[model samples]
Target: MTMEQICIRLVKVDMLSPVRALNRFPSVIRCCASARTDLMRTNSSSSLKSRGSVTAAASSLCLRSRSGLNTCITAFRPPAERVPLIIQPTREFHTSGRLRALPAPLIWMVLKPLQKLIAIILGRSIRKWWLALPPNKKQLFREWTWRRRWHFVGAGAGLLFFVSLFLLTHLDESPVTGRTRLLVFSRENFMELAQVTAEAYMEEFKDSLIAPSDPRHQVVEQAVRILAERNQDIAEISSVPWTVHVVDGPTINAFVLPNGNVFIFTGMLEAVADIHQLVFILGHEMAHALIGHAAEQASLSHVVELLSLILLTAIWAICPRDSLAVLGQWIQGKLVQFLFDRPFSRKLEAEADQVGLQLAAKACADVRAGPVFWQQMEIYDQLRGEPTIPEWLSTHPSHQNRVRQLDRLVPEALELRASCDCPALPKADPRVIFHQAVKLLLDNAKKQENIAQEKKNEKERAGVILPFPQSPPVLTQGSQPQRGGVLATSALPQTLLSK
Candidate 1:
């Protein structure tokens, strides 16, 4: 046969799809009569023995060639079964070299088109499902069927509502800073809450409460009276009936109600450097009431909850009311607590710091004591080796953060103090002050016991006949004094602990 005719019978296998390989291979060469004759005549026994060696060399050349092909000569096989690929040149041609694999780029080229095709099919399916919606729901899609367009519309509407609500409120002025704020609750509501809450606290701590006679009580009373009397701009200070209650406890905390009711724990007094630091702290607690932070925080908390609910509702609208909604709710809960509630709490704390600094400065208390008071607190926390919570997760700022803020506020407070007549008071060690406070209490108790003993001696000297030989001890008014220098009070119910 001629070379063109011989080439016509050769088949090239395409690895991509072997069944489709032979169509491209047939009839691919021009005639070469002499070359075909030489290729056809390898019948001698010697020539047959050398055929294998010659074939191996030819196959090596094919693989090493810069040009690639799926072509080779081999033993013949029937068309029904998979042909065994052989690499040799002889009179007969067999299956092409075991089909050449496609290049990486070519495989990617095929997949790219397939991916686009699948995406188009998916989009069409989503369109069909969308059209099956009730006619009323489809009204928006009548003119604009694009999925992204609807997303933008929903976002824009929500943003507009939020901006309008935020901008359209009446602005109320903060007491110390005079910064205007959007207050949701009335001034009257604060006093009402304060009155109820303060009375409940009073009833609970009535037993173990200290009187004016207690040195800690005397100091705190003196400070609150001076600060509240001077800073009458806060409605709570001016309108509410002011009362101070000192409870002997180890809990280091102080709080003031809008009704001008103050609760100071003995532990707080023990932590103070002097009456000035106590006064400075008292001013801070008072600021929380003065600035209406309680009411403002309550309002903001509700607003956050409402916004979260709205966002969840929007998610349910877009997503299937199934596992996706559950996931969204979990995410929303975390964001509301950590992002909205905690940060909002920190902001209110910072605001109270500024207001308290101003209040303390005006009251003639050493504003520098603010940093000192917090320094003591920081030390106490360190001694306990308490883990510091991250600012994002904690409701209160870290001690270092508070100390830095207090330090910054000091210069301004000092500038205000410079103009006042109260000369800077001498500073005392907090540890020394705490020791003295304890010693004073011991002295007072000893004096009271001595007075009781003298009174009993007088009775015996007067020859008074006792109705009962052993008299039951008469306890002091309201509260019972406990041993170990500790005091106990009848506390409110468990429900009030949450408050």
Candidate 2:
């Protein structure tokens, strides 16, 4: 066709949008062209205007150069060089120019199916996937959808019920701090577990026990008695029977079980340069029991166990992939334990340190010695040259972290000690304490994030704690058509959710 006839034909094509037509037709569009083609194709109104003042004229089409595969399109030129069309050709370096048009009927057929496909898959591609599934699978998908839509409501109600049950049934107050605590197990239960662990330890080390006549054994026993007697006055502390033993081991360690069984390694005794350090260490171990650390740990573990069972029930009902569901169950359980349980464990340890200081200061033991004792432990850990575990991995805070924490509570401890008519102890160097404080602040900002903050993060990450503590995840294709939308959180551990 002649060029004017071709332009009129293009303008008459109403099925394609301007933009779509421009994109679809890559060559041979009529009425306008690159600079060289402009002289022949452009209207006469443009002939008077200089190139710098080129203007929009009514003649129109955009053509991509077939020879170079270069795209050229029209733009308004001030509408000001106001009467001539300007075509800017964005080109490649091929030294050629040519054009041709594909047959419109052929183009229409080729594009129609593609356009329909695009429309079908726009943001709902998974619907097509669902339709492609087996009849059994489609039923499963619908069931999952129904559960997701409805289970969230049920889970919310369940969580509120369980939380209320916990608060009402397990209300126990902590001594010294006077804060109410939720303790699912009784002190008697803790005593039983403690006795079992203690008996096992005694059997393992019976031959290596330090003789009661030994001066070291005598000193440890006396210190334990003093600290225990002071802490026993607290209402939270059960008057659990106390038994202190010194093991003749090189490992510098001491610990107390939930029941009042205390074990001190000879290495720890030998490591201490002074009696006060030993006294503070004793207080720390005792405080773990006094604060009901074991009970709190048991409570969390029990909740996770219960939640995991509920999760598995939901998984069995929702998941079509049998093999993958088992793997997912294991992963989610670990994640719940790691993300939700471990941080609380660390918090318990930190809480013990605080209460230990109060207990030691009240017992007439100089609580200022706690930092010095922890510093010694840090030095010992250094000599072993074991790789330092990162805060996220370790159950205990680094010794430096302990010392920094202790430094903050020193003034209060000292004041408590004075109130209890305990002997005055000299404070440590201000410069050293100041440096420790600064380091801890930096470490906290950089690494030791508050656990609450950690849990608050990554709600979208897999293994994220579902708002429902024991509620099975919603498995609806409507909410999570992809394999991992909700159940993935339950299967992955804290590590997956961490980043």
Candidate 3:
């Protein structure tokens, strides 16, 4: 068959039954190609034009059989090379050579299974962990979750309350202290209370026995006096009326009452061996009063206590009473002691130490003695085998720590002591002073005992005696002479005059 006949037959086969074209075209094409075979095929003008330059392409085409020729013509035009069809959507292509426009639903379809798998894994892990936990632990976890929810709610309420308070109230600064302290109460009221309390204390304890004029007393007194004088030079101290009173006590303690009333126990005198050493101890106590530390501490504590009470009340209201009651009390106590009191005390102690050293220097006392005194205290504690007092308990720093701080202040103290022109007093004999003190104390005790006896006698007489007049009145209310009257009032007076 000729090329024209082959092309016509392939097209006719394709058009007639396209499904069987692949199977029958090879044999038909081979038969058409064979010189001996006489298979006739037909072609149209349109088919000849579409099969571009068939004469040139016919050289390349070899028909082994009529069927192969027909198959090649029908199924193998340009190999239909599967060249990744580029379909442009509405959006532009990305620089990454990927299409910018993705179908939203398709993306969701791809990610949905992955997301579900991740969720299933997390859920299973959590369930396993829950199952592995002890029963009590699981219960605790549940309780903790509930507690956290309540905590957040409480926090929100507290924040709202504070915000409202901030909006409504006025914040006033303290005038006397010059620090910007919160003045919730009027200064007048505070001053009035402090003044009344001070007066009552002084009046009640005016005769509270002081350490007699012993060597220790003189040392302590001199030290205190110098500190007071030095402190007076400070502008803050100038307005305060500083007074020192050395009380007789066995406990090694010292305190500065709010109104600059300093009371140093005799026990502290025994602890301090010399005037220079005594000054450091006294100076520190004085600083507490000078700086109004007590007032500051009281104010801070009051605020903390108030807040704790509010929280405790709220806890009681919301939770099971028995369950949370112990916890609430524990939290409240810890808040009061550690959060409020301990921190305030520690800070004040440190501030007092700093200020006291300055005061001691100004007072022209031996600043070096400060560290020596603390060292001595530490040594004494060790020698006695007594447990060192905690800083929190005594509102004072540890001896070792205080000594180290004092060491830093030595140069300043020495400079001040050198600059001063005042002559030092001669040291007294401790033995003689101790004896005198002992005698004085004994005498005072005896006096007290006598007074008590006199009072007891009077009470006994009152209890035994009848409430009756022993003698008649000489002057009647109506007939009594005026202020210038010379008339004798009683028989005994008239008899004595005649003699």
Clashing pairs in 2: 79-82, 144-476, 145-476, 331-491, 332-490, 332-491, 335-493, 462-489, 463-489
- Kindly provide the TM-score of model 3 when superposed on the true structure, using C-alpha atoms: 0.47
Report lDDT (Cα) of residue 211, candidate 3: 50
Q: Would you give me the overall lDDT of model 3?
A: 0.54
Taking the tens digit of each residue's C-alpha lDDT, what string does model 1 give over 51-115? 22234222111111113232333433345653333443223335776864543333433565464
RMSD per candidate (Å) reads 29.5, 31.6, 32.6
Task: Return the top candidate by TM-score.
Answer: 2
TM-score of every model versus the real structure: 0.53, 0.54, 0.47
lDDT (Cα atoms) of all candidates against the true structure: 0.61, 0.62, 0.54
Candidate 1: pairs in clash:
207-479
The ten-residue window of minimal lDDT in model 1 covers 57-66
Distance from true position, residue 5, model 1, in Å? 99
Off by over 4 Å in 2: 1-163, 235-238, 313-323, 426-499
**Mind giving the per-residue lDDT tens digits that candidate 3 earns over 333-437?**
776786668866877787677677767666765565566666656655664556767676665678877767767766665566556553442355343454475
The TM-score between candidate 1 and the true structure equals 0.53
Q: After superposition, how far is residue 471 of candidate 2 from its true place, in Å?
A: 60
